[model samples]
Target: MSRLRPVVAAAFLGLWFLSLPALAQQEQMPPPTVGVVTLQPQSVPRILTLPGRAVAESEAAIRPRVTGLVTEILYEPGTALEIGAPMFRIDPTTYEANLKSAQAQVTSAQAALTQARTSFSRTERLLGSGTTQAQVDESRAALEQAEAALQSAEAALTLAQSELDWTTVTSPIAGMASVAAVSVGDLVTAGQADPLATVTQLDPIDVDMYEPSARMLALRDDIGDGRLQLNETLQATLTLETGETYAATGELVAPGFTVSTSTGAVDTRFRFDNPRRLILPGMFLRGQIDLGTTEAFLVTQNAATRSKIGQLTAWVVRDGKATQVELTDDGTWQNHWIVTDGLEPGDTLIVDNFAALSEGATVTTVPVTLDENGVVREQPAPEAAAETAPAAE
Candidate 1:
């Protein structure tokens, strides 16, 4: 029994020394450091981002007006061209020959009319002396017939000239020319089903956007009730598919004349300066339009989380303990959640290190400050550290 007592004492001392490290570790373990931001009511512009497409202000199909062999494509594909710029040239040999023939016929008809007029004058002068009335009438009829023939020849010449002009296909509008459908030496017809090329106006391009009619109507109601103040000069900004914003801004042209019955959306058109031609037709884009300013409580998206049930929640620190609060997020605005409810101004919102937090979990908050760009940066929370030390001890 004496030997057992010594051994037990040694084991007890060993256990006590082994537990000291754990006790020290617990004392040194600080409450989980979390980044926190105080909620602030701010006047933020209510901008609506909508999907849209870029469309050309004008488009023209380049088609030949005279049937002939395509001689040449004068303009390069994907090149900007001016109005009346030559796009394609058809074989004008036939048209030129026809024009010459029509001109010769006009000359011949003029000679005949001149001879008929001379005979008519002679017959009229001799009518009082020896010429019969029938002869005079016949001479007058020949002159009238010759005049009609001359007029027909002149009309044919005019038509031939017009057709000759059509042999050189030109762009009716100033725009970028598309690739030639019919290459050089390809046979093309007048007013054919296929066009030789296409031209699309790119500068001052149009962007087509659609908004749900219900939302549009609600906006109008808000404006009427003075709940929302719309910008007098409504401006829009575009974001491309690559997530880069277009440099030039845009203006709202007008809403579509008719609402789509099937889609329940109203089409709206916006005009944007596209001097760089960065935006092409049929490009999918997003447009952010400023709908005016409103007062709202704003919270960073990093502080908010969505549950499996689609309820948005955030951890708010109150009395040095983290509490889960249900947030009514209207939507995201500039990387922040626009909270309409569930939070108030001056509430501390936990941003970082709150992911694994539970309701009423003790926390040491590091207060953060937002810069001019709205980026949150951590600040020293001396008071928070002091408050949490007693609990940790």
Candidate 2:
């Protein structure tokens, strides 16, 4: 009986140890080390991307008016030129000689005309006193012939001057000129070859893009209702083919006078500058035009999760437990929701533990770092650590 009592007593002590709260506390449990974030409202920039091409606001074709052998090319490719600068010389010596001969002919014609006039005057005076009628008629005919000869010579002299001027081809516009088609010493003819060079106006450049016709109507309505200002200086930025931002801002310009039926898009143009002249004409670029801005709740994508159906969602800690939210729209900015339907301001979301978390699990919250674009700046969780930690007994 005494032995039975010790056994019963030992069993009672074991049961008491198991029932104590301290024993429960001694059991190993999952750690609460997880990243968390709270939803917030802040102003964000709304952006849109469209394909565009850089175009010079103005351009001129450097062409000659008359046919000649290209004697010299003045401006090389990739050189800035001033207005009226001589770009090419087409053997001006020949044109100069022609001008001298035409001038000589004009002088000879003038001398002949003066002699004829003097002779005709003397004859008319004699006839008035008692000269024959045939002599009066002959004098008149000689005077008329001299005047016609003078007129012909004068016309030839004008032609020679024009031809001389055409010998030196000059730039019509001030800009960066490039020789696109020809070289020096080539025999160029009228309408045979294109311009020897092209001068593109680069100070004020144009960005041409197409927006849907419906958007145009909507924009017009917004402007009329004071939602948008038509003349407002909306900011524009450009991204080159390499995705680098251009160092210039553009101002919105007027739309094209016509719409394209085939494309259903209105041609939109913006004016900017190429201070460095790095932006070449007809190069494709990506642009972002600022629409109106608004405030929105944002959270980090690290705190986000996706369902089996590829839906994006987030785990938010509320009342000391992890709560899941299924985001209805796109989310990302400042590492959070740029646009969302499920999250509200002040809700705390977990950013670290994705695999170890369930819908109703509890976790400790921490401050999350996010950039201006709403990307999570926090260090990403290690997959190996997360995977191994779950297997710990």
lDDT of 1 by residue, 1-393 (tens): 988999999999999999999999988887787878877788767787888999999999987889999988898998999999998889999999999999999999999999999999999999979999999999999999999999999999999999999998999999998888887789998889888889999998999888888888877886787756788888889999999999988998986777889988788899999999999999999998888976677877766789999999888999999999998765568778777679877999887776658788788877787664567676657897687777655
Candidate RMSDs in Å, in order, are 8.4, 11.0
Q: List the candidates' TM-scores in order.
A: 0.68, 0.60
Off by over 4 Å in 1: 1-38, 97-158, 257-264, 316-325, 344-367, 372-393
Worst 10 residues of 2 by lDDT: 329-338
lDDT of 2: 0.76
Stretches of model 2 off by over 4 angstroms after superposition: 1-34, 91-163, 183-185, 209-231, 241-243, 255-267, 305-312, 317-323, 326-337, 360-393
lDDT of each: 0.87, 0.76
Error of 2 at 250 (Å): 2.3
Candidate maximizing TM-score: 1
